[model samples]
Target chain A: MASKLDLDPRVVRSARRLAAKAGQPVVDLARSHTTVSVERAVLRLAGVQGADQDGIPWVNRLVDAVRADVGLGHGVAVPVFHAMRSTGVDDITVLAQKAAAGAVRFDVPSSRSEVAAVKRAAKRATGGGLKIVDRRRAERERLVKRLGDPKQRPWIYLIVATGDIYEDIPQAQAAARAGADVIAVIRSTGQSLLDYVPEGATREGFAGTYATQENFRLMRAALDETSRELGRYVRLTNYASGLCMPEIAALAGMERLDMMLNDSMYGILFRDINPIRTFVDQRFSRQVHARAGIIINTGEDNYLTTADAVEAAHTVTVSQLLNEFFAHEAGLEDWQLGLGHAFEINPELPESFRLELAHALLARELFPDAPLKWMPPTKHMTGDVFRGNLLDGFFNLVGALTGQGILLVGMMTEAVVTPWLSDRDIALQNVRYVLTGAGNLHEDFAPAPGGFIQQRADEVLGEAVDLLAKIVDDSLLTAIAEGTFGIMKRPADRGKGLDGVARHDDDYYNPVTEALEA
Target chain B: MSIVRPYGDTTGDGMVQLSFTLPIPHDKRAEGAAVQLANKMGMDPALLVHARPMGDGFTFFVVYGKVSHLVDTEKVQVVERDYPLLSAKEVNATIKRRLRRRLNVVGACIGTDAHTVGIDAILNLKGIAGEKGLEYYSELSVTNMGAQVSVPDLVETARERKADAVLVSQVVTQRDAHLQNTRAMSAAFREALPAGKRPLLIVGGPRFDELMAGELGVDRIFSRGTTPREVASYLVHALVGSSS
Candidate 1:
């Protein structure tokens, strides 16, 4: 795809270089450190399962025991595998139970041979789980090939977050029947802040469903059934973020989820998860996502909710470029980069729709191969269903005209209540109306030369390049600490989950990460 | 006088400008197609004023045209703000005089709705749109739980805090998670708290229906562009004053 705005190739190259330079420090930091979540993810890959009587996951319990005994510098894998080898227990759950019952202890490996023996045991243990992940990935590709793609570019990505996994299935199927191409099972509120993923089937959730491994398997099966029924693949999405980012990503992969909301800075900026912890966790998670072929949707749109969308447009673009660099570094292809933006400029601002077009089209042109997740209006819904519907109509038009990849349908009765099924039906109708009405609108539209849209895109690109240069100079971590991206200042060392981060010892071993990287 | 029309350049003229994109390269043929498409959409004598190529096989166009449509203003139904916007001082004074204690309010982004700007705008001390948030009010005790708060936890917090109002902000309305979460929160409160002791349930987001609070089982529903002062005033009215 050629540049729509004829964006200066020099600026693009400069921005790319600066973003690469800016992200290197964080990437190096991620390489040097491993969070408790990363260790838990390793244990999960080694086939650790279930919680104790306190509902704590065995992976968490094992990591806790290891952290308490060996102080976590040598990584949980080394200590846990040494414990497994010494105890002569092939099952990690049994080892966890014994450790939890205080029947076993973990300390630093006594010798080089002990370390080598533990690494070999860890490799053998995690090999089965990695095979399962590989099988799931192959199964996902097989199913998609068999079921076929949706008939359009911007697949209608609806959501079903009924707290209860069972309750979500029917709603999801109804949405697919109603023209939705993708169904995202929204995780329950605050799940991201939790250090462990919930086990088994969960019945009660507050705002959204839990992103447990069992829950993921169930929802994936349901969506697969729906896909077969609809004759087009219906992708399932869930978040692999928060304190247990890599663990959830591993689970999403094992359950064959098609997409994951795996952003680097979202937890740090929004949930206040520590920057070091988030960066480390995001790298491992993106590795799993990349291996599983999961398209990741970054959270650049959330910036608009906190900062002024118009004044901060450049920040979103800058973040996208950074996210791109990070994703590429994690071995993800451009096709799997569902980079996010939103149609969230204040509607009262004159020519807001045109401005939205300029922004959305700029993203579309900038990352042409990437499937951009175009978010609907949340910052300006206004609670008036009539106006909200109209605003969504305009949003859909912009998506259709600009060629967004994933379009989350907007509900009209937003801010009023939990949408009754009727509200979803109406919202879907609004999308269908605009998308079908202006289905080919993109073929008939282009910005005027040197007009507001063209000029805005150029100006935003210029601002983004300057910001990238500053970020490269000061480093991304310092910029984040000083509130650069989302206006939320999150210091590198201060915030939630900082205690979970550990500087990896040279001998620390993670078979899963090594396998993914290999 | 009762009727209205799009007042673009002049009243009753119905003149408008529409912009669009075509896949064909920008040329005489693309400009002609833009005009033809505009005419089909009810614009008469549509004139293509601008045309530009956007990459390969794509063209954008801006067209000016006239329409023959008018809207009757009298029949336009809207959900208007019935409550008056009060000053922060008035809100604090009313709460102090009537309740004789601080108004405890707990706000959160319950469910998976991680967007917190709306909840923060009303509950955080910084506020939005040049107005102070509920935290700035002297008589309002605001405890913002931040994003992704569970309903059961929100209920427990409301109970423990002895809250006068429980504000839940939902930013992700995908598949009606916001609405469902609100309903679930309201139901949890109904089950947990006695009718007389239950906190005033308030849910605000950009996409809420102002009139559906009763249906959604909440005390009040605030919509877009809501200021903290207005929320504070409403709390004073519903919880402290004669309106209760």
Candidate 2:
């Protein structure tokens, strides 16, 4: 398809170039430092399992012990593995248990051969983890081939978060049967602030289910069963973000999750996670996603929720470009990029639907091969469900006309209440009607050469170029401090996880990072 | 003396529609169960208009029924606007003349509730609907603390700012979090400051019951669709005008 927006190719190129320039320093910074979560992720990859009786993860305990005694600058892998080899406790979990019990001590092995032996052991254990990830990826491919993929352009993405994994399973299966192609289990509120991932199947969570390994396994099995019954593969998604980004990514890979909310700046801007910590953790997490064949969904849609969608349009575009740069740098392919945009323009605005169409089309045209995740109207959802449903209809129509890859089914009860099962049924019916009615609309839809849609898209792209240039000049960190994106002033140095980040020493070794980079 | 009954198609018909979900599949028994439940709740001769299976072992039903219950207008009680609704100028002037200084107000969304839209609407310059927020009032200095603030931090901020009023908004009522957080906040404020020195604790949310203000240990409760001007007027009425 030709560029209906007729955006200046020169401006587009400059925006991409400036985004790359803005992200390069952050990427370099991420490469040189490691957070406590990154090291714990290594321990998790090396088969360290189970929390103590207090519900604290053994990985957190082992990493804390190592950081307390030997410091994390040398990485947790060397000291923990060295203790394993010397103590003859071959199992990392047992070693962690002993360390938590004060029976085992983490000391940096001084001798060269001892260090080399520990490195080899760490490499072997993580290599086992990699094998599992590779098998899961292959298994997903097989299932998609056998059961068949969704024969639709915009796969209906639905959310099922009942705070219990058991409850979520049935709801997710029901959604899959209701024509939803992807199911996302929203993590419990404030899970991002937790430094350690929870264990086992949790029964209680606020607003959403806990993203635990067991929960992941349970949901994956249920979705697989539903896929075979429906003859169309159902994909699973979860947040591989927050303080434990890398650890969650590693777990998602092991559990065969197909999509992850893995934005680079989302944690920094929204969650107030330290920029350095988020950057370092996101880089490693993206590498895990790349290896696991997991599509990464960036959180540019959130900026519109905090700031006005019309005014902050360029911020979303800039963040999308920067996310693209970072994901590509982390070895994620174009197809794995689920860059986000939302239909959050005030419905009362004149020509709101046309504006939404222009924005959605702009995102679609900019990243032609990427499966853009188009969000629905959230900021303007009044308690009036009648009007909310109509807004969602317009959202669905715009999605169909713009060729969005992933459309999150919007509930009319979004702001009114937690949606009932009947609400979801009605929402799915709305989506089905619009999608089937306008299935072939995109093929014939074309904006006039210099029409409103065309001019608006071009204007957003030009503004995005200017914003990216400013970000590059001030450095991304300084721009963030000045409230450039989301109108959130998150200083680079102040946030939750700055204490967990450490500069790598000369002898620092993480076999997983080494393997991923290689 | 006036009495009222729910009206659907005709006046005084006592006809009403109720929708609910039961833990049973969509079947004749499920419809019968819904009717039975409605009948137990004072609805007689209930009609099961619609039934559908929500998921496995769950059914949703819409029932139309007639109830004998009537509301007596004279005996009915509600939280009326007892205070005068002042304009922005009246509020600022009242604060200036009575308090002899600008009133300090601190607002936040305490606990793990990250939703700030409600608080922002009440505190930010660009308020919800047409009325401007408290920040637009010249004699009311507003400090909006954004979201996810802990109760202890809120108390300390209130103390530091010497706030005359602390307005807290809770949007996420999941698992009754808004109620729990409000109780915790009110209790913390009570514990930290003497009754006379304490700031007026006001909680607002869509789900909060306006009549539960005293039970929840707050000075007042603002339900949904509360304009910022109403809040400003209430502050003046409680702190400046009433005290004066």
Candidate 3:
């Protein structure tokens, strides 16, 4: 099998665990967290608070390895040496000796030095008792227990971002009543990078909307009521990838959010976030997701939004597998995987519709049982709202014919503006038509079962394996600079917002950051 | 939009690349303080933006500001399209020829992309083209997909079949997530594709420039620089020509 880059050992480890439970096909990880306050308080009590990686660059490397180790074989040492803060196991020599003896669980090489160098770096991060398995093992057990399947008949999903969490609740409730299976309160335009997660529900936001716990709790409770009233489960989602990616993941887990939009490259390609920082946050966030049993969806689909959807199709596939690899390392199961793709290729193209089918079908087969989140098209819309409506109907047909597990609703008012109720009804009517008419389409969807489709999957998998080999050889950090992932070049310390970075001092603060690193 | 959670309730993980040009000479003092202030607040120091001195003590910067956040990326609820391309004339013709009806369109910015110029170009529709506006179409129907329609309400109104199109105008590019609106509409089409068959997918805005337009997967991409003629021509050609 060909791979894109070195599979983060942590991701591999996580994938193994998820794969083990997936044999049952119905294990649910999207459970709710009832006491966010208590959990957060506990995290604070555990001395884990803000950003603690002062001077310690590449925290993502350790997080990635830890995430990969979740369900994989025996875990490896992720040396976290803090030359600044002296813990009981002060220097790298002591830490390396511990890691060698299986006392320390991590390893980090200082300035790309030798074995002793790794040891020296590892020592900087220990001293604290946070790395011990006994400290948090019981909690992990409970979080794992919350995992179970809903066995739902395709629950409907919808978005509810009004900038204000209070406003989002009413809308979310309405959507739940209207047959939405999942409700996503869109995050503020650039919420991903704010190092400090917004504390609570808010109003008056620009662009999209912000994602808040009050919003999540209010909406979750409302949906729960609706679920009982309607007899089903309603899940909530938010984003967990930015400057404080790990911190946000901790929040989501404590808050009991069912789904999170956690992608590695979203920050790199779209936000121009530092790649190393993004990956680090992703790793720790995945660990939190694993502990909280949250399902994560990647942003490979966004690449299509910028790059040509058709030409960039393979990148989507590559990203999916890489995401999968990452998720595995994070201890996430395939079912928790919500890899995204879209019906965005120009509908006018002769092969556009076929390509859509090929892509959707390929994703379904490649990662069967993953409630694949099928995205609606957004590239070619015109402000002529009516025409937008009609285009949505066509898009809906594509969703139905393809057997997409999670199909986001399409609105006609797209390019021009936000839709009103009247617009939604027409949109819903279109969806109803497709669902009722083509419900059996999947039964008829037999692309030779194992011929072209399987070959494609196999071929992609082979490519992924090959890519992984190259990454392992070249190193993951090196591959990122080469623009091998999203084909978007991202320098380690350059881009749209490098000035936002703050270097850690000898007295770097943030206890939560301290505990997690420890 | 209402706020229920208390202020600062979240840890504020979302970051913004706030860019403003100040007339300060190039200096490291202000730059250092700006980064320091953001860090003093608990935001991760990883994504700080570029803060450079413009002149005489003022400066410009693309700061990565963090705001606590929660969102699920996997579960999206939207109604939109893979692609819908049309010109003012083509859009008009699409309504007239396909459904043989007229369209009503109203457009404006809801929140703050603050780019009404985009809305004016497509909605004024005196026609950058030689043809009349989509409103003048004999067979087609149009309605603006008004900016900032509350998500819930958008769902409610988009369901109305009277309107054939919902034109939306947004110029906010502070972050790329603005595309979520288009995604919302495409999500609503699950039923339309098989039986009802919707009006048509069309979008335009300054940010929806030719290149950005394709990335958003819009049907008809009309950017700020587009002329009425070009916009109309593309819409009519795309919708009318392609469907027929």
Candidate 4:
């Protein structure tokens, strides 16, 4: 069955060649060789290659490959350097097109072969890949450390992505100071899809701004600076989705960014990105996130923009579970998961707040350790700027009540236009009041057990299970073409970048493969 | 027909549609000014609801209380009737048999609008219509000029190459970019060919469609939600079936 993303024929042909060399179907080889399930098997079949091996240590092996992919020059090709076994594919002309015009990379693996015998513990060395990391315990530790528990939640999460590193740095610092736990620099809205990462800082952008390495570095430094000042680590985030998701993840990891928006399905849904490509890229990017200690932010909030947030509430839950599954496969700890949702459906809905509480609580329960990114509403604003502000106030109230880990402040002028600094101040005031007035709200909070709130949460889970079951039975790839998620119906045989994809023959030319293998 | 139970009057109540994308953490006072600007545009302040901020600084809105200002939506007929639509199979078959040759379709992002996103949505190998792009059809040759092609140069080349259809995508309409290029495109179109033999002109943008295309002499317009299938269907129906 074809994927929601049409598999590039070049990727198909490369997979055929790779399989021929290994004497097996790439899908079968990946299924047998790796722990990822069949859902992502289609991605492996699309010629998305991985790194040589994890457990191998070579910090300098990382390069600035992502820069050149986005029209900058050749640096370390961090994603490529980390490419353990498949580093050779980076140079393979056939795979270059699928490489996202040198813009993207598929899943690459890392190795922790260097953590020598522990002198302190004496009996054993615990850090040799998943052999040492207790996934379940680590996830729980993360959850307790940050969010407390499903019953008790924490503060709001917001984003700051101005194109200029100079601009983003100060803005991120301000957000962190203003009580934002999470700061996401919206990568110049569509930079993820670009094959290469821009070299340095950029000033202008179409919507939000660009997410260059320099910008990432500048913002990460600023956040780190604030984290020290605030006495708590304020996490920084940017998109690692799009064509170069894996490569960006590598960069984020190198730069010590706290989190990255690395969803498997978001690319296909909003960007018309092929499902196979997205999955493959996501897997690769997640692997990088695993190595970098970066939390991965999924785009369930985006699903609200296209589909109805109220109606598709379950989708957020479902995506969280799937993201949980993918994050696990990529070896990401629950602590490193920032699953997303939003409060953007019309506030006029009678039970709007109740629905939001249900959704937020469900995410908290489902992932438990993930720092869930709660979004602000904007879908149905008709330009009544003042009412828009009041609506945002209600959004803030929901964040406080539901105990959301990350609360994105809603700007009242959502439907009207871009906000000025004055708007930011008022928004900050709204957030400050809610945080101050309701600082202890979570302490006294108690949703009636097994009541409408809990029941609704359960209902969304059921819907999610049904959707996943169908995905399992019909193939997630086919479901994408069928438009099971977004209203779009992109066929498996079509989409942009079809011509840009070139298949890998036998001898692809990446050097890190041997270096990692060594 | 009047509003039942009398809500605040919204008629003529002329309104200005003011929308701009700003940075996050919206300011109510700044938003008020945006609404005030609408009032300046002759729109009553009471008739607007979307003077709010768009997240990440790119807000979208529509002000529709009552335009004591009217623009004749009825007289606002688009160039939709200029061509008929064919199915994917029909589209492929028509070019092969009737044109007696493969029709070449060239697309580009004219002027300083470096955004190739919208045009790439149409003419690339992943054609918009359930099928692939014009490249998929054996009967049509396609050359996508990607981004940053000047309007005059684009016209010179399309004419030199004798394109069957010229697909123009206008993005980055910030600060009347669209208006400037719209005029440039017309001038180039006028310069590129004698009015009679110009290739079927198709204009698409976030806000433009064949209606604007007809108003500007473009053969057709495919608006934002326009599908690749619909575009393919129209192209085939027009080229194979009729011209006038």
lDDT (10s digit) by residue, model 3, range B51-163: 55421345555556553444554454442333355554455656576645454333434333433445544553333223344545444444444334443444345556443
What lDDT does model 1 reach?
Answer: 0.86
lDDT of 2 by residue, B55-129 (tens): 688888889999989988989778999999999988988888888999999999988887778887888776776
Model 1 chain B scores worst on lDDT over the 10 consecutive residues at B52-61
| Candidate 1 CAPRI-style tier | incorrect
Question: Residue A224, candidate 1: how far off, in angstroms?
Answer: 1.9
Give candidate 4 misplaced runs (Cα > 4 Å). A1-156, A226-232, A443-445, A448-451, A497-518, B1-244
- Which scores better on DockQ, 1 or 4? 1
Ranking by lDDT: 2, 1, 4, 3
lDDT tens digits by residue: candidate 3, A15-50: 333333321111111111111111222232232333
* Between candidates 1 and 4, the TM-score winner: 1
What lDDT tens digits, residue by residue, belong to model 2 across residues A1-518? 55677777888888889999999999999999999999999999899988989999999999988888989899998998899988999989998888888888888988999899889999999999988999999999999999998999799999987888898998899999989999999998878888999999998888888899999999999999999999999999999999999999999999999999999999988888899999999999999999999999999999988778898998999999999999999999999999999999999889888989999999988898899999998889988888999999999999999989999999999888877888898899899999999879888889988999999999899899988888888999999988888877889889889999999999989999999989
TM-score of chain A of 1: 0.98
Which tens-of-lDDT digit does each residue in A269-332 have in candidate 4?
Answer: 6666655555555665676577557767777887776556766776676666667667776678
RMSD of each: 10.9, 2.4, 22.8, 12.8
Question: Lowest summed lDDT over 10 consecutive residues: which window, candidate 1 chain A?
Answer: A413-422
The CA lDDT of each predicted structure is 0.86, 0.91, 0.53, 0.57
- DockQ of each two-chain model: 0.13, 0.51, 0.05, 0.08
Candidate 1: stretches off by over 4 Å:
B1-115, B123-126, B129-145, B148-226, B229-244
